[model samples]
Target: MRYTSEHKQATRQRIIEAAGRRFKQDGIDGSGVATLMKDAGLTNGAFYAHFASKDDLVANVVADQLREQRASFDSTPSGRAGVEEFVRRYLSVEHRDSPESGCPSAALLDEIVRCTQATKEAFTDGALGVIDEISAGLAPGDPQSVRAQVIAAFALMIGTLQLARALADQQLADQILEQGVQNTLALLPAEDRG
Candidate 1:
């Protein structure tokens, strides 16, 4: 029997959500279509009905995950305080320990570097949207003026989290997280440093 359009859309969303979590937990190359389908509680044969290929799913997941991240930042108080809150939370031990629910860029950047052009483009768009959100927080009146600072600071946060996760020592990881928060906040304008 044919599924309703609503059912089809819901199934597609389910697949994307599962793929997002699985991809972050296990690198994209580590996650096969069969495993991803199983994670979504759907049969492997049902994969094609929603996505054309693994590349398509990866691109969709990248966009969805980053969009969610941006929206989350949007919920915080605006201005310098918002940016600081984001940095602290992003580089926190909780975020460090939970790769599956953390930033997609931190979890999948290495794998994303080798993904298809379509996937890369999706990442680019999503990343820019996230940057824009942070930039707005830095400069509510003129985000473009502070765009460079936001990009650099955000990059540091992603890298710091990635490095912290790679290390086996939890104490060192926590130290790195603390330093990351300080350094990232320093990148902001002196006037906004408060």
Candidate 2:
């Protein structure tokens, strides 16, 4: 039987959502097509009807996840206060422990570096959009310098989350998260009081 266009789009959305979680939890290279199909409640034979290959899915999934993330941050205020809220929430223990729903950059960046050029480009575009959003919180100053600061903070966030997730000791993990929150707050451009 042939599927309707709505059915096809729904199937594609299901595949992408499951792939994002699987990629975060198991790494893109680690997740098998069979497993991804199973997670999506579809048959192995049906996989090709949606995505051309795993690389295509990887590129699309990263773009989708990061786009959703950027939208989530849109409501946050733009200033030192905004960056502090971002740091606290992003570096929290809960965020560190939940790779499935957490930032794709922290969970899959290492793996993304080795993906096809199309996937790499998707990741880069997503990451840059996030950095631009965070840069909005920086104080008025040289655009170049403020942007540099926000980009560095974004790096520190991804790195700290990755490191905390890798550590075995919870105490040390909490410290790692807290230190990132503390340090990033300090580096944020102070609000003008005049």
Candidate 3:
């Protein structure tokens, strides 16, 4: 039986969503095409029907996940309000433990650097969008200063989560998360405080 166009689209979407979650949780190298297809409730033979290759799927998934991240930030309040909220949620223990729902930077930074040029470009575009939003929230200042701060904030966020996850001791994890949050919050401009 031949599948309808809608059915094929839905199947393809399912595969993309599954791949996004797996890629975030397991990294690009960790998720194989066979396992990804199986996880999506489809067989290996069906994989090529939707995606030309794993790289195609990976690029699409990266773009999709980045778009989701951008949407999340956009929905939040603008200016300092959004930054504070973002810092609070991003540095939480919950965010550290939940790789599937967390930022892709912390989950797949290494793999992203190694992906195809298309995938790298998608990641870069997504990251820049997020940084732009954050930069907009900063106080009026030199563009260079704002850019530097934005980079620092991004690094702090990803590094904190990474360290929290790596630490075997629960107390240490909590310490890393809390201290990271405090430090990040401290970096915000005094005028931005609310």
Candidate 4:
């Protein structure tokens, strides 16, 4: 029987959502299309019906993840509160350990750089949008300075999470998160900084 448009859309969404989780948790290359399909309770043969290739699904998943990240950041208040809240939530050991719910930038940075043009474009747009949001949270200042600050903050956030996850000891992980946050806050200007 032919499937309705709504059914097709829902099936496509399920595939994207499953791929997103798998991509974040197991890196793009770590999980195969068959495994992803099985995780979504679908068959590998049905995959092509929704996506032309795994790369296409990867791009879609990246876009979905970016939207989720944007929504999370947008919900937080701007200025110091927003920065503080972001750091607190993002740098925690839980965030470091839980790839499924954590930031996709850190999870897929390497794969993103190597992905197809469409995937790269999606990543670039998502990253720029994030930078713009972070910059807006800063006080009125030199445009260049705001841009630099946003870049620095983004680097710190992702780097700290990576480092925290790398360490063997829980205490070391906690230290990395705490010190990283303190150091990052110090980098901000006295008045407008978080």
Query: Model 3 off-target regions past 4 Å?
Result: 1-7, 138-145, 192-194
**Cα-based TM-score, every candidate:** 0.97, 0.91, 0.87, 0.89
Please tell me which model should have the higher TM-score, number 1 or number 4. Answer: 1
lDDT score for candidate 2 against the true structure: 0.86
Q: Which stretches of candidate 4 lie over 4 Å from their true place?
A: 139-145, 190-194
Instruction: Give one digit per residue, the lDDT tens place, for model 2 in 57-141.
Output: 9999999999888887877776666667778989999999899988999999999889999999998899888877776545434
lDDT of 3 by residue, 27-125 (tens): 889999999999899999999999999999988888888788878987777667778888889989889889987788888887888889999998889
lDDT of 4 at 162: 82
For each candidate, the alpha-carbon lDDT, in order, equals 0.93, 0.86, 0.83, 0.82
User: Which candidate number would show the highest lDDT if scored against the true structure?
Assistant: 1
- lDDT per residue for candidate 4 within 90-179, as digits (tens), equals 887788889887788888887888999999988878877777776667654443557777678788888888878778998988999999
lDDT of 3 at 12: 94
How does candidate 3 fare on TM-score? 0.87
Clashing pairs in 4: none
**Which candidate do you rate higher for TM-score, 1 or 3?**
1
What lDDT tens digits, residue by residue, belong to model 1 across residues 165-184? Answer: 99999999999999999999
What's the CA error at residue 21 for candidate 1, in Å? 0.3
Which TM-score value belongs to model 4?
0.89
The TM-score-based order of candidates, best leading, equals 1, 2, 4, 3
